[model samples]
Target: MTAAAVACTGLAYAFGDTRAVDGLDLTVAEGEVFGLLGPNGAGKTTAIRCITTLLPVPSGMVAVFGQDAAGDRMAVRRLLGYVPQQLSADQNLTGRENVALFARVFDVPRRERAERVAQALGAVDLTDAADRLAGTYSGGMVRRLELAQALVSAPRLLILDEPTIGLDPIARTSVWEHITAVREATGMTVLVTTHYMDEADQYCDRVALMHRGRIRALGTPTELRKGLGTRRGAAPTDPLPSLEDVFRDVAGSGLDDSSGDFRDVRSTRRTAQRVG
Candidate 1:
């Protein structure tokens, strides 16, 4: 069998007195789109950071394509591409330039840089805007530019943390379209974290619902909703459960009441309306 694209076993991380990720275990298969869903402070970002080599992997607990992230940092980095929660492109740089910079950072040979840059831009449908300053692009376009930058390295695994955090429905859909398209073309594995349960239901081959620094549940969207069985105090005539229902069943009550939690609810509602 092919080795897992990403594997985390007994992984844990902490900041001072706070434990961010605790004994987390997950496996994402090659060429699969996997969603990591959780509320604020659920250790989703901490896990992503460890998988992407941003933060130190506690001992040898995290591995990318069988290369230990802590022991083989450079080898692991070569096979991974990451787009963080925040925007990474410089406002002064043109879309092409931003992607070109990543090509250099990824150590693409000089002979192949130009073609690789063009292919990356074309993959995300950014070729038309290649010469335009990233500052002038729409929010969705900027996200696409970031996607192109990540693609320049031709990574086997793409790690995205809240890639569509602040965009409107249309923009969010647009960003995902390019992502799905590229995945279909290249068969790259995607590991993404999002609060939008609706998106996870639609795009993810499998999902893990994380809470309190651990994976509370893991399965396909259909399997999870089915596992929910029935809602509390609901009439027999009530509609079947949605992924939202599954989320609420598993992680809703455990979620901390915070501004970020409120924002995530608002975002999920918007995405639901769009998907509906």
Candidate 2:
């Protein structure tokens, strides 16, 4: 069998007394799109941070393409490209310059940096606005610029944390189209976290629904929907359950106090306002 592109066993993380991620076990095969989903503060972002080696935890294990995220951070980093929930592109820099910075940071051979940066920008259809400062771009353009920055390294695994939080539906569709195009062309594994159930159903090969720092359910979208319908004792002739229905069933409603706190709400709102 082929080694998984990403693997996490009993992965746990804490912030002081608060345990963000608790004993997560996950795997993503190479060349597939996997969704890690949950309501706010469900440990999805923290888990992604741990997987990306941004945060250090005392227990559990995380690996990227068979490389230990803890023991071999650099090796794991080399194989991954990450876009965080918060903004990453510098507002003062042009779209092209933003991608160039990533190429430099990733040490993409100085000689090929120019071509690689251009390719990354073009991949996201940002070539025309490449010279414009990121601050001046629309929310969708900014998100695409960030995507280009992540692509500058040509990673084997792309991890995105709410990559399209504030965009309109059309913008969201455009972003996903670019992502799908890249995945098709490069066969890179994509692990993404999003609140958009429709996007997950449309793009993810598999999804893990998390709540209270654990996976409540995991399966293909159709399977999960059907499973929920069955659990609700729906007859075969009943309409299928929506992914949102499954989300509520697993997470105990987005209003569940355990889902998130005021700070989480503030942060998500702030991000939305910025990108809106």
Candidate 3:
């Protein structure tokens, strides 16, 4: 059988005295769009950082396509493409130049580099804006450019963190459309974290709601909503709970304390303002 695209067992991490992640276990199947949903301070980013080998796995195991993340960092990195919540595109770089940079960083052969860069740009429908400086692009276009950067590597597993934090509805829709189209074409597995319940409900094949460094609920959008309704003894004729309702059920109204620290808030707001 083909190995799972991503697997984590007994995963744990912390900052100083704070526990960011606690004995986590998760597995994502190949070619599915998986969402890691959580409010701030839920440890979603920390978990993704560990899986992408950006942070040392202080404890537990993380694997990508069956390879151990701790023991084989380079091998794992080769299989993954990541877009952090923070903006990664350089405002000074032309869209084409930005993509080319990633192609080189991912070590695409010199002979194939130009073509790969072009393809990645085209994939996000940025071909016309390819030569324009990224600073001039609109918020949506900038996000798409970042997606192109991640795709230049041709990774099997794509990880995105809060990909559309600060955008108009139209721009948000455009980003998800491109992501869905790319995934359909390449069969790449996508793992994303987002506070946007609507995005998760519409785009993710399955979602895991996390709180306090642990998974509180996991299932398809339909399943989770229906399950919540059932558990609460809602009448069969009652309206089903929305994903947001489920999120609130898990995280509660008391998010300020559990939400990530000041740095996280600052970074997220900065990204939003820039992208907005």
Per-candidate Cα lDDT values, in order, are 0.85, 0.90, 0.93
Worst-scoring 10-residue span by lDDT in model 3: 253-262
Q: Where in model 2 is the C-alpha error above 4 Å?
A: 256-265
Reference-based TM-score of each model: 0.90, 0.96, 0.98
In candidate 3, the residue pairs with backbone N, CA or C atoms under 3 Å apart (3 or more residues apart, or in different chains) clash, namely 41-260
Per-residue lDDT over 94-150 for candidate 2, one digit per residue giving the tens place of the 0 to 100 score: 999999999999989999999999999999999999999999999999899999999
Q: What is the C-alpha RMSD of each candidate to the true structure, in Å?
A: 4.5, 1.4, 1.0
- 119-138 per-residue lDDT for model 3 (tens digits): 99989999999999999999
Tens digits of lDDT, candidate 1, 1-276: 778999999898877666778899999999999999987878888888888888998643888999998888899999989987767888799999999999999999999999999999998888998999988888788888889999999999999988887788898898899899989999999999987888899999999999878899999998887667653544657665888888888887755642133443565455334323
Over the full model, what C-alpha lDDT does candidate 1 score relative to the true structure?
0.85
Clashes of 3: 1
Count of residue pairs whose backbone atoms collide, per candidate: 0, 0, 1
Residue 188 displacement (Å), model 1:
0.5
Ordered list by TM-score, greatest first: 3, 2, 1
| Residue 85 shift from truth in candidate 2, angstroms | 0.8
